[model samples]
Target: LNGFRRTPRPLIRAEYQHWAVYVGEGHVIHLAPPCDLMVALSFYFFLYNVRATVKKGKLYVVVGNNDYRINNILDEKYEPRPIQEIVQDAHGLLGKELPYSVLTRHCEHFVTELRYGKPQSCQVQLR
Candidate 1:
């Protein structure tokens, strides 16, 4: 992470637009559903997961939206939380379960909450 900028960058694969927070050493923390699909309702709740650390190399194949325009715009509006606090909070949330809502608390929401102390998803906004 150059500039220690732990921003929430998108991971696009075909039609999927997933989001993750880069926290240096080529690792990212993200909230994801149990499967490849973005939303899954299992009886009662769609499971929103926190992947403790994922390598950037594994993401190279599906990387898209290189400009990270959403993040840039959001960064401009909200004063981001300090890198250390953001990272620490992310680590602390690993293995925890967050309520999953496609139009609300998804991956983008998760990382933004970690980075900016506010939960906002451009995906949700676009919807």
Candidate 2:
């Protein structure tokens, strides 16, 4: 149920609303750009030396923190799928590599797919 709020960062605009699947226990699954290995190399050369590259992004299970919060704007008309189905759908994509596109494939699409069995992005559709 996580959604985006106002932020100054150029990457996060007002029109955008990020989404994630709440897998309970304060954990969430969503798609995001891979962590910068170059940055890790500079900070922890010895301990964190692993080579990994992603074309766009990957599904990640993360904790609910300051990064994700609820937004006022959401589709009230939408209904959620069964909890078991949603959980299974989210787990099925765990650690899978997914190409990300702001218009075609984004966080909204990911969460919607898990909850509705179809990939969709209201923001992109609105535009």
Worst 10 residues of 2 by lDDT: 50-59
User: What is residue 117's positional error in candidate 1, in angstroms?
Assistant: 0.8
Best by lDDT: 1
lDDT of 2: 0.52
Per-model root-mean-square deviation over C-alphas: 5.7, 9.3
On TM-score, the leading prediction is 1
lDDT on C-alpha atoms for all candidate structures: 0.57, 0.52
Candidate 1, residues 8-71: lDDT per residue as tens digits?
3323332335676666675666675655433634312544442223223223322443423235
- Give candidate 2 regions above 4 Å deviation: 1-9, 12-15, 35-78
